[model samples]
Target: MGSKQSVLQENGYTVMSEQHNTIMLKNKDGDQFIIKKLKADQNEASDFLQKLNHPHIVHHKEIIKDGDCLYLVMELCEGGDVSQKIKQTATFSEILDWTVKICMALKHLHDQQILHKNLQPKSLFFTACGTIRLGEFGVIHEWSSGAQITNPEALSYIAPEILKGEPYDEKS
Candidate 1:
């Protein structure tokens, strides 16, 4: 087995920037991608990302477990995330367009019995073509017997039932 950095290099990916657990990589062809280092408790989330595949959702390309840390390679959205767009003063039409696309992505996730517990502006990304792509599944949970609260990092984004320590279904 090779080191994580070596493996990525051997696969033709060069590190462009790294911040905390997320690394931005660029292949020899200049195509960019992101690699998220998953903590031990986030194993299930990695699996969920692999199982999820929708045009509006960020695509999980591969999973590489290097020693204690698990890394997930995902499609990169060159157009940046929703928060950046909002900071730039997005137009009303652009906001409406993003809203519909976000709803579509959420509906798809709900249909798959998955809950995106963290649905803040930062979680929504845009491709180079301006298409919305939902990412950040750090708090994803299976909707079995309703979803369970995974973490309190995004308390404001959490459902009321979850904050109350009550079971939260997809509707919540």
Candidate 2:
């Protein structure tokens, strides 16, 4: 409705950092959040993210449409992503716990006939409370029983069938 800065400020959020299309924000109450700007062409992915509701998934608080861009407001994960965590003293127990959490999230998405076409260590974020959450859902797609959905841009972490341009279901 307004300039992205003014709109976020009016909603009690102040920009903390920004890189590319992603902006980190903080409210007066000390709650942190992330806002990812999606171009008009990525509306389907944006719409898919808005419908997700899961404890292990980055919560989509709201969507702000500013001109041709869609800003997705979501909870902040201060603990960084699994990639960074792996570099630290990642204990066996921690790895096992994270694995279970990730599986749970994947199961949730698969059960809904949705496929997270881009799943990787960097996509798994950790909150300040150390809770794992699935993020970076730029290539998620709603799949039918026999429909083929593939994201050529996402080469890594994608199934072989997707890379081969073959029809793929949730299993892929």
Candidate 3:
């Protein structure tokens, strides 16, 4: 959209939150979404997300272009992210439950030959109903058979092999 104000009015969505380049919106139906604006040329991540489908993954609605910017509309997770939950004192059972959910999401991604290079608490979100869903595909990568990729920016959550400057497979 050209401007956040105009886009909100045109789409019938109210602003829930706003960031420098992104805004969270909610429609009259109570459906929530996150709209992110990026340079027109930066469509790789949005394109990839559009083709992805999984219960534990945030869903992509559509992409719209206004001038030189591309806007990505995606499902919103209202219960917040794992980082907030981690800050609270959680029971062992609760931790195990969340772990299992996250593992299932990772398994689904692997099945699709996708690698979530950044797998931290911030990337893990909770739905309004309390189900864990994986979000933030900004650093995702698709791998062909036997292909390896190098990524060292994830820090503590990154695999050691990546930090060592070695090409690592999806499992890394």
- The residue-by-residue lDDT of candidate 2 on 45-137, one tens digit each, is 777778888989999988877788878899988899999999999999999999998889889988877888788888899999899999998
All candidates in order of lDDT, best leading: 1, 2, 3
TM-score of each: 0.87, 0.87, 0.82
C-alpha RMSD values across all candidates:
2.4, 2.9, 3.4
lDDT of each: 0.84, 0.84, 0.78
The TM-score, computed over Cα atoms with residue i paired to residue i, of candidate 1 is 0.87
List runs of model 2 lying over 4 Å from the truth: 144-154
Tens digit of per-residue lDDT, candidate 3, span 60-90: 8888767788778888888889889888887
Tell me model 2's lDDT, rounded to 2 decimals.
0.84
Model 3: weakest 10-residue lDDT segment is: 144-153
The segments of candidate 1 whose C-alpha lies over 4 angstroms from its true place after superposition are 145-153
For candidate 2, the TM-score is 0.87
Show model 3 residue runs off by greater than 4 Å: 7-12, 144-153
